[model samples]
Target: MDTNIIIVFAIIIVAIFFFIWGKIRSDIVALSVVVMLITTGILTPAEGLSGFSNSVVIMMIALFIVGGGIFQTGLAKMISTRILKLAGNSELRLFILVMLVTGSIGGLISNTGTVAVMLPIVMSMASEAKTSARRYLMPMAFASSLGLLTLISTPPNLIINDALMSGGFESLSFFSFLPIGLITLSLGIMILWPLSKLLVSGKDREKASSSKGKSLNQLVSEYQLADNLYRVSIGENSPFIGKSLQELNITSKYNVSILEIRRVQSRKRFHKPVDMKLAGPASTFQENDLLYVFGNINDIMTFVEDNNLTLVDTQETEMGRNALSVSKAGGMEFSKIGIAEVVLMSSSKLINKRVKESNFRQLYNVNILGLRRKNDYIIQDVKDVKLHSGDLLLVQGKWKDIEKLTEETSDWVVAGQPMENAMKVPRNHKAPVAALIMVLMVVAMVLNIFPTVVCALMAAILMILLGCFRNVEAAYKSINWESTFLFAGMFSLGVAMEKTGASSYMADGIVSGLKEFGPTAVLAGIYIATSILTFFISNTATAVLFAPIAFQAAISIEANPYPFLFSVAIAASMCFASPFSTPPNALVMSSGRYRFIDYIKVGLPLQVIIGIVMIFILPVLFPF
Candidate 1:
C-alpha cells in the first residue's frame, strides 16, 4: 500500500473510533477528520471543503426546511387526528393505517419529522384505543426508513443519487426505486405486524401505572352512565344546526358534558373547556361546527339521532378541515402542529430568558406552552413565568420552528411529549402560495430545471417570507449542520480513496476473493459487510464508505452497478440487533423502556426479514 493510502486509512480508523466512542459530538469529530486529512496532504483543501458545497449536502439542508415547513403549517397533526377518528373501529386497522400514512409521508418529508410529529399522536391514539404504543412506534420508525422509493424521499437516496451523478450518470428519477421500495416496505410490514406482539413486550407495567394506569378510552369507557366524548361536525341540513345545546336537550335530558366548541375557517378557533357553559345558552349551531360533548355512550347515540346531528367519525373538527383544504388547495400536505420539550442546553444563550422577553412566538413561531423543571410545572400562561437554567420548555409550534430550536439553538434538546395542546389553528394565507413554490421547486429539480440547492433554498426562503415558516431564524435553525459536516468530511474521505486509487485496489481484492461465486455472491458479500459496518458506524458514514466500493465491485464483475448499490443501500439501514445501530433505534430503545436484549429479541427477526426481502427483490427489479 502507498504511504499516503496508509495515512488516509489511519485517519479513517481514528475517526471511526471517535464516532463509536460517543464522547465528543459526531460533527466535531468529522470536522476534525476533514481538517486532519487536509493537513496530512491526503486531500486538497478544495477537496476537503468541497462537500460543504455539494448538492447532496445542500439538498439535505433544504429538505429539512421543507419538513420543518410542514410541521409549522399544522399538516402532520391533522393526519394523526384523522387517523384517530377512523381508528376507533379497530387497533389492527389503525396500526396498518399509521404505517401506511407514515411511510407515504416519510417518502416525501423527513422521516425524523414524520416520527416526531406522529409519535405523540399515535401514543395518544394508542391510549384512546386501549393498546400499547409499542405496537405502533416501531412500525413508524421502520416505515420512515421505507422512504427509499424516491430520489427526494431521504438523504441517503439523495447521497446515492448524487454519487451516481458524480460517477457519470443522470440522477435517479423521482419514482425509480418504487417497485422495489414498495415490495420491501410491504413485506417488512407483513412480517413485523404479526410478530411484533410476540417479539416486543408491552409497556412497562409499573411505569404505566405510575403515569396513569387508565388508557384514554378506559377513562372515558367506564362512564357507562356518562363521560364519553362525542365530537360531531354539523352538516347543512342537520336539525341541530339552528339550536343551542340547551334547546337540543343534550345536557338537560342526558348525562352529558360539552367539552369544547370549535369554529372551522381558513383557520380553527377552539372554544376553551371553560367555555362549555356558554354552549347551552350563547351558542347557535352552525354548519360544520365541531362540537365535542361528553356523555354516556348510550346517551350520546340517542342524542345524535334525536337531534339529527352527524357524528364526525373523522378525528378532525371542522377546524382541521380548513387546514387540510388550504393545504390541498395549495397542493401539499396540511401544515403540522405539535408539542415538544426543548431542554435548555448548557450552551444556549436563552438559558435565563423569560418566555415573553424571548419573543419566541413572534420571532420563531414557537409558543412556550408550558414549563418543566424537575418537578416544577407551569401551564400555557408561561409568558409570566420566569425562565431558569436547566428548564425544559414545553413548546407548541409549527414543526419547523421546533426543529430549528433543537438544531441551531445550542440551548435546547428535543424530548418527546405524550400530551396534546389546545387546538388553535392560525391562519396563514400564504399556505397555497407556499405549497405551490415548494412543489415547483421540487419539480424543477427533478426536471433539472435548476440546481437543486438553489431551487430548494429559494423555495425555503420564500416559505419564510410568506409565513409558511414563522421566520428565517427558524428556517436557519432547522438545518442539522452536524449531519451536514459529517457528509462533507465523509465525502472528502471517499474522494481521497478514489484519488489514491485505494477504492479500485480494495474493489479488486474483494472481487478476486468472491469471483468464483459470480456477481450475485459479490453483491451479497457487499450487503453483509455494509450491514456489519453499520452496526459499529453510523448509517450515513457506512453508506459513504461502501457506496464507492460497491460501484467499483460492479465494474470489476462487469455487472450493472444498480443492484450492488441497492444492496448496500438497504443493508446500510438494516442495522437491527444492536442499540448502537441507528439513532432512531437508539431513540426508541431508551424511550420505549427496553433493555438491550429487547432490541436483539425484536430486531433480529426484522433484520433477517429485511435481508430476505432485499436479496429476493433487488435482482428481480435491478437485474445483474
Candidate 2:
C-alpha cells in the first residue's frame, strides 16, 4: 500500500474504534478524521471541506426544519392519532397500525421525527391497553427505518444517491425506495410481530416505569409547593427597578422563587394590551411588574417588605387557591408560563457549580424551583446546593423559553414529555397549513418539478412563513447540528479514501477474493459486510465507507453498480441488533426498559434474516 493509503486506513481504524467505544461522540470522531486527512495533505482544503456544501447535506437540514414544523403544529400526531383510533383498543391492531403509519411518515420526513411524534401517542395507547411500551416502541422504531420510501428519508439513502450521481450513474427518482420500503416493512411486520412479543412476554424483573421522569403536578406535590405559590407586585419606588434578576440574588438571599413576570402593557393602538414575560436572570424589573413567586409567606413577606413590592392576589392556579393566596390580582396564565424538568447528564458543565453560580435564570431564562437529589427534594437552601450529575431540577419558564433547554442535549435531557401537553403546542391550529405544505412538497418531488433539495427547502421556508412553528427561532432550533456536521465532516474522509486509491484497493481485494464465486456471491459478501460494519458504527458512516468500494467492485467486474449500491443502502439502514447502531433504536431503550440481552433476542435475529433476504432481493430489484 502507498503511504497515503496506509495513512487513510490508520485514520479510518482509529475513527471506527472511537465510534464503537462510545467514550467520544460519533460526530466528534468524524470531524477528527476530517482534520487528520486534511492536515496530512491527503486531501486539498477544498476537497476536505466540500462535503459541508453537498446538496445531500443541505437537503437534510431543510428536512429537519420541515419535520420540526410538522411536530410543532401537531400535524403528524393529529393524522396518526385519528388513523390509530381505527385500531380501537386492540393491541394487535395497534402494533400493525404503528408499524405501517410510522413507516409511511418516516418515508416522507425523518425517522427520528416520525418516532418522536408517535412516541407519546404510542405510550398513551399502551397505557389505555394496560401494557408496557416495550412491545410497541422497539418495533415502531424499526418500522421507521423500514419506511424509507423517499431519497431524503434517511442519510444512507441520500448518501447512496449522491454516490451514484458522483459516479456518473443516473440518479434515482424520488420514489425509488417505495417498493423497497414496502418489502422491508412487510417483512418487518411478519418477523417482529412474534419476536417483539418477547419484550413483554416473561415476568419482567424491571417494572413498567418508562423512567420518563415525573409530571408537573407530581413535582409540585412532592416538593410540597402546592400552597407555596404567591403573586407579588412591584410598587412605586421599588429598589429592584433598575437591576436584572441575576443581580438581585433573590433566590439565594430571600429563598423565594420568582417563577415569572407578568407585565400589564398600557393600552397601545395596535398591539395586545396585556403581555407576559418569563422571568430570567437577565430579565429587568419594571414599575408595576407582577412577580409570580413560589415560597413560604414569611419569606415572601420579608422580600416584599425589603424591596417595597406588594403581594398581589391569586385567582386560581394549578395548585388551587390556598392560605398563601393574596386574593387581589389576576394570576399569571399557565398558557405562556409552564413547568418542565431537566436531569443533568454525566458530562454537564454545571455539575460542580452552586445553583447561584450556575445562574439558571440568567443562562436559561428559567428558575430552578425545586431540585431532586436521589429521593430527597432540596428545598431550604436550593441556591447554595452544588449540582451533581443526575440532579433533577424542576424548571419554570415560558413554554417557548423552556423549549430552548432541549437544544443543550449533552448537558441535560428534558425529563418526560412535558412539551406534548396539549396546552404547550399553541400552534396546533396551524396543522392544516403544515399538512398541506408537506403534501405539496411530496407531490412536487414525485412530479420532478424541481431538484429534491429545492422541493425540501421550499417546504421548510413555507412552514416557517405560514406560522407552522412558534417562530423562526424554533424552526432553526429543530435542525440537529450534530448529525448535520457529522455527515458533512465524514464525507470528506470518503473523498480522501477515493482520491488516495484506498477505496479501489479495498474494492480489488474483495473482488479478486470473491469474483470466482460470481456476482451473486460477491453481492452477498458486500451486503453481509455492510450489515456487520453498521452493527457497531452508525449506518450513515457504514454507508459512506462502503458506497465507493461497492461501486468500484461492480465496475471492475463489468457489471452495473446499481444493485451493489442498493445493497449498501439497504444493509446500512436495516441493522437492528444493537441500540448504539441507530438513533431510533437507542431512542426506545430507556422508554422500553430493555436490556442488551433483549436486543440480542429481538433485534439480532431480525438483522441477520433481513440481510439474508436483501442479498437475494437487491439483485432482483436492480439488476447488475
lDDT of each: 0.61, 0.76
Residues 99-174 of candidate 1: C-alpha lDDT, one tens digit per residue: 7877776666545445544554565566567677777766667777665667655555666776687878667788
Best by TM-score: 2
Candidate 2 per-residue C-alpha lDDT over 231-297 given as tens digits, one digit per residue, 9 for 90 to 100: 8889879988989987998877888878777676644422323466776767898887778888878
Candidate 1 accuracy as lDDT: 0.61
Looking at model 1, residue 329 earns an lDDT score of: 13
TM-score of each model, paired residue for residue = 0.51, 0.56
Score residue 67 of candidate 2 by CA lDDT. 68
